[model samples]
Target chain A: MVKISDEEIRKMVIARLEITPSKRKIIIGGAGAFTKKELIEKIKQHDPIGQKIIEVHLNYLRSFKKQQFWG
Target chain B: MIITRPNHDFATKYLFRWSQTVITLAKKRNILVIDLKGKRASRVELTKSVRKNTADFIFINGHGNDDLVTGYNNQILVQFNDNEKLFRGRIVYARSCRSAAKLGKSCVKKGTRAYLGYTDDFIFYSDAASKFLGPSNLIAKTLLIGETAGQADQKAKDAYARTIQRFENSSVSEKDRELIPYLQWNMEKQVCLGNKNARLKI
Candidate 1:
């Protein structure tokens, strides 16, 4: 499967969280210290923590669908 | 007991605010609190504090990975590679990322009585427009009220379940439902290793 674009990933995360970047707080793995836009930009850079942040949200996404994860 | 509270950013500050009640409860029980706040929350200060006391409990709240727990300015307060020696004979509970993945086992190997923490990121959410304490109240109350480590771990899991259920039943937006998976993930990943029945010597 082709990987989603960073923009799409950001939108998916924001839609999943239902929080705007301007006034909300989001805590993730590597970019836990960054805000919405900052976190998106950080993740876009493919940093290690940023990758983990994306992977965590993806894990949640998958688990919410299959109702189970790495057991 | 030592609590590493670093409020240098938004998420840390949010967690720090949520933990005010737990801090008060521990103080009420006369637990020795080596609070690492602001600039004092550095590796040097943490090492000194841990070395200076025969403290039985270590509770850290910050960002971390499988090998370490960070502090103010993301300084490594405890890392498995370098700081495993400091946690011997202690019960460690890290509310950070993945410290339990490797650091917890390292502490157990280094002779800790028990280590309780999340194998994944300890995720949380809040109403940006309102205040929500999340599970900190119940989890901390149960875990710090002199219960066995195993019991405390179970209580925390139960609290997580109840909180998730509450979120499901609430009339929040659909996107908010995504938060449930994270809560469930945290509940399932939070683990206890070594002595299950250990208790803090507070």
Candidate 2:
């Protein structure tokens, strides 16, 4: 299977939404209400590639939030 | 360099030129050329060939809609029909426009590391520009030579930009200049929807 990385998700989401990085952060933060696994399931319902990508983006967002709080 | 250019005569001319370039490049890199144009090969046939030969990279050039590429008959659609087992590891460059949309997710599910194409209805002009820019050939060369998808894509973009620069340098009418910008804009809007550095693992 194709391993979708965080950078790939970032580029795909940015291109799909035609938004900037700040806007991506906002949309991802809103979407991050669910866990990485849950987001993957939801995204898979639409597109498998999208599912893998969303999982990567969710992981990034989760870690970013954690880092923001801890560091 | 397997190719399939159907009824469109203008597109066929462009495809032939592009195929020659790819074949020459592949020869230089010691890659075999599996030419399949005008053979009326169906998706099933192509799938079988893909299964038989584990190609490092696959490049398809033809007319396409959001769902599939047009085969000889309008009733048939030429696409990568291999299940996860057949094409467990490969990178694909879909020269057909809109073949990389959400509908192409199955390609990745079937184990393609990267699939590059347009996200929307790309026009014939943009298709012509892509040919002139050699995005398909560039992608093939990069993948076969062990470069990342992003690297290949960047090279393709640079090639395209260089073409635009050449057009800008040439003496052209105002109307043509206006059209050139539109073409560049459309090309920029084309999105690559896969992991740039990811390699398919069978």
Candidate 3:
């Protein structure tokens, strides 16, 4: 099995979105909805890559709804 | 042209206007416009119409998040099912905010060449609508002719910048000018592209 790092998962997400690192980092870190653990689990189940991308996006949704967790 | 509007009054108006402008511009370039409206169409309908008709590019204008596009009555619009592979080889320009984030994996998995969308909440300013039309048209044209995602993005950004420049040059009233900067800032902030080289066409 190929081991994928959290950072690699992050990069894969960014690459898929066609966004730069600067933009990707901001969306993933500051958005605040995604927990690192939950994302890793989702990645493990649904994707070849890991879960960093989902984590960042969870944050984005949280920020958008102004909610603390996934709605 | 597949325009899906949930219940947002403002977004519906903006999409209507944008669709009108796109159709007019496309006509000038001799491009045919296929109108796909309403929320009842299934994924099969979308794929068959697009593939059989051979649309060069597909534009999905609707309210979307990172995961899915919602239809009227909170119906989720998805391009693929467990056994079906759709949305292949098309450049999808999603007007919904933040719809492009983390959606790349799904798009890639479905075999779509690339996806473009906002990374944050977007305010549909009137001037921004006019400004976005040209760039959007150019991007569609390039994609239809087989330009790579990266090339299409550059062309689209250049068009967006030109639109900003024109907005600055226009002699609008002071009230509008003050709002223009805010609108411009939002436009700059929200615009994002993903998967520059994702080649979906087989």
Candidate 4:
């Protein structure tokens, strides 16, 4: 089972969200890149590739607030 | 602009809705919009449309990875290698995954005026009920509104900032407010390559 670390989440999620504009990688796409779950599993199996897990979930979470506003 | 929107899955359903929004907005400006929506959004159609050279901009929404973007039911629409030349002499904004990583650059090298997308996965949050109608729509709309690619990109970033502010200051639960980080991640991941100076002709 693949698991993302807390610090990794902090950097990719927390820092990414907190900063208005953050520096990021600029490499273009390659053929058949891994999905969210696939990337996680790969990372779990072989501790290579420092790729971030953000690419895995295209829009993983879903929510609707009670304010009746469009989420 | 040529847009490909495949609406087979949950995420794609939202993207298809967003693509329609783009169509409506583009039509308002009297822009000739060629949309490969739903079932029509196949690789064959995409290649055929490009061969016709009928448009100078492309805005695609669907599932993709580093070098490939799929259409209906995750059918491989366009991937790396010789296919990127399909974008030559045009501006492209792929709302897919890491198409920008290599495909975006290759498109530029092959003569695409500008390419806008994430060097990684292009993620966004949407209401499950309302689907894809979210701030994610801002970037595509801003790009097709006849603004410079760079300017449109800036506007998209600004819109993201505004949305972030909205979520942060809202009284919603921490669970409901969980989208801020993902929103921020998309902003950071979204990238522009090629001539930053490129823009669509109105």
Docking quality (DockQ) for each candidate: 0.27, 0.02, 0.02, 0.07
Candidate 2 error regions (>4 Å)? A1-71, B1-8, B73-87, B124-136, B165-176, B198-202
Give one digit per residue, the lDDT tens place, for model 1 in B9-48. Answer: 8677876776677788889988878887777878888889
As a TM-score, model 2 comes out at: 0.60
Sorted by TM-score, highest first, which candidate order results? 1, 4, 2, 3
Better of 1 and 2 by lDDT: 1
Q: Which sequence of candidate numbers ranks them by lDDT, best first?
A: 1, 4, 2, 3
Could you tell me the TM-score of chain A in candidate 1? Answer: 0.53
Chain B of candidate 3 vs. true chain B, TM:
0.69
> How would you encode candidate 3's per-residue C-alpha lDDT over B1-202 as one tens digit per residue?
3434333344544554566655565566566666555454334455567767665456665565666554443345553243114556666776555566556346756776666656544443344355445565565556555567677666776665555455555685443343333233334444334467743242
For residues B1-202, write the lDDT of model 4, one tens digit per residue: 7889887766777667666777898888888878888888898999998898668888877777777777888888877885887888888888887778887887788888988888765544334212113445666677677678887677777776676567767685553355554565677678888887787776
Which ranges of candidate 4 are over 4 A from the true structure? A1-71, B128-133, B170-172
How accurately is candidate 4 docked according to DockQ?
A: 0.07
Stretches off by above 4 angstroms in model 3 are A1-71, B1-8, B24-32, B39-44, B51-53, B71-74, B79-84, B132-137, B141-147, B163-173, B180-202
What lDDT does candidate 4 reach at residue A13? 39
Better of 1 and 3 by DockQ: 1
Q: Which of the numbered candidates is closest to the native, going by highest DockQ?
A: 1
Task: Give the alpha carbon lDDT tens digit for every residue of B96-126 in model 2.
Answer: 6566775356677766677776654433232
Identify the leading candidate in terms of TM-score. Answer: 1
Docking class of 4: incorrect
